[model samples]
Target: MDSVQFPLSTGTYSINGRKYRRTAYQMKVATDDVAQKFEQFEDTPDVYDDEPSAGCLAPPGLPALKKKIAKAKEVKEAKPESNSTEPTEDERISVIGGKKWIASISVPACFIGKLHGMNRRALNALENDTQCRVKTPRRDENKPCEISSIVSLECVQRCLDRIEIFVDDAKKTARVTHFVALPCDQHEVQENFEVFKQLVLDSEHFDASCKNPQLFTKSARLHLTLSVVCLFDDVDLQRITEAFKVIEGEIKEILNNKPMIADIQGIDMMNDDPSQVSVIYAKVSGEKIQEVANHLNRRLIELGFAKNEGGDEVKLHMTLMNARYVAQAEKLKKFTFDAKKILEDLKESYFGTFQLTEICLCPLNSNSSSEKFYDKLAIMRLA
Candidate 1:
């Protein structure tokens, strides 16, 4: 009991990382003591924070500095950024006042991942400072190494395994009509979504501004958004539907052996900061998941209804929350959530696996209004 010892006096200091990540919302602050003590459990014996010594997380020479600043609200004590999770005040959808048909695949709701070992004090500091964010690992650390060497031939063999996820920014693109997708049921994944939602809402690490619990996502609305399609004409819908029919048997054939299974893991932000998050999604992974996505995207692109955004490369993610509105981009930017901290805390979380059985064609009403984001237009199942 109480085996550790603290020789230095109780005071405050600050910690800063290398640079600000553009994809995440973060609040920066100083000090590894008081608040940081909780985030960084192990501390060096150095009396001052001005110079980095051994066993520190930051690089050397970048000393922890003494700085006095007003204590912002603690995560637990701070009120939620949004009174309700269902954000109704700001509607940030790109296409509004109408619905479009698209193809998409649905993954099970419980497929979210899980993580552990986060510093609470770090979360508190981030919550207080509002300008800093957690830095993700470099390319290889996040994904399997793309390049491999053939030792026998003494030659390097590979292209970097990367998913080129653009913002669907294809100019001169026709109307976004139908998308291919795999759908999930609320009964299968709602309970976990609710739990994760509540955890984010109650955690002190989160900034609750403008967040609505209702906006998290309805169980009925859970599904993976595959690709954005462009319709361009009244006859396009028929063509798109027929194109799907053309390859429906093949897709089912791929999934026919058994229900496709995958895990729904932890959460991540679409951008660097959580505060300006347009979408929050759970990481998903499984065997041959890439093959399924590739097949679907190939067929859709072949018919000229969808763009080959990633080309046999699929980003397997399930969108959990959104702050988008048809008419409110600037307003939404001002309202940031603590998705970063929440993601860190649950980095090792695993919601469970999804036995994906079928794919569907659904209609998108408005990206802003997600209560019933899509209506089931058609369904095709594996034999």
Candidate 2:
């Protein structure tokens, strides 16, 4: 027997070594019959339902296909319900003062400084950018800032959002309570600092001009402040300590297991005027010292313990004299010293060099011991 051929493009099929083609009318009739049979099957809910028959086998994708169809039907049924209930953006906005909208946000008194810079310039900028009216609180007022707009609540919300970001940044950069420092109490540094203190105290010009001699910094309390932070309580202290502990290893690695040799020399007043000075400090300088100080300060900010304060470079100075020190001397009124003679005399004086063995976390309000250094709450060794 000859091999049978399959259906051809000409619409003819071969079977049992014979070929036959149906007319167009016959083809149409056959198609109609097949479609009608499928319609009947669909109408019989039991046979053509989403679930497969218990005795029939199911394909691997049959369950997934059924779930998809069920989900699509649910979505179609829910569309009208959602359309009927949901409000448009404009309707969702709460109306206040008829056409105008308003929002009040409470702010802390400490953050009032942050709002001060929102002056006429900043207000104009905000109005132009948001096309809204923002009434900033007064410097002394602890009240909330008011925002309003005739356009939309979203515009007022935008102004509020900008103010919040500005205040948040101010908080991060302004608050501080404790400080990190390297004590300047090594034997050689202390000896030199004492000599400089004595020179200022002994000068008749300095002595007569400054009646209060107790304004000098105690030798034991000499230190180079590295960074400052605002810690609220013991819990905050513990949190900061843990943060410090983690960064301690990085600081040590930065030092490369070597003690920092700090060069303390020369005398300079904190204020620009040399004649009327409230603070006198010995200049501290060195490459490694600055590198370590900057790294520690940057890490403190990254860890959120300290403020950024505009820069990472630590102003390394060992304060030798401050007028505030006179507060301990018999409830005296705060005084400034005439450092004109002192400046002329010791302008080129060298304090001395010493090895910084450790970095310490110290309280700002605590009294210094006989050793002259503030109480160290925590210490990280450099060598």
User: Model 1: what TM-score?
Assistant: 0.49
Best by lDDT: 2
Per-prediction TM-score: 0.49, 0.54
List candidate 2 stretches off by more than 4 Å: 1-175, 327-334, 367-372
Q: Which regions of candidate 1 deviate over 4 angstroms?
A: 1-171, 232-234, 325-336, 366-373
Tens digits of per-residue lDDT for model 1 on 280-325?
Answer: 7888887766687877777777766677767677777787776654
Residue by residue across 124-156, what tens digits does model 2's lDDT show?
777789988777677666467776678977787
The 10 consecutive residues of candidate 1 with the worst lDDT sum are 157-166
RMSD (Å) per prediction: 36.4, 19.5
- Quote the lDDT for 262 in model 1: 71
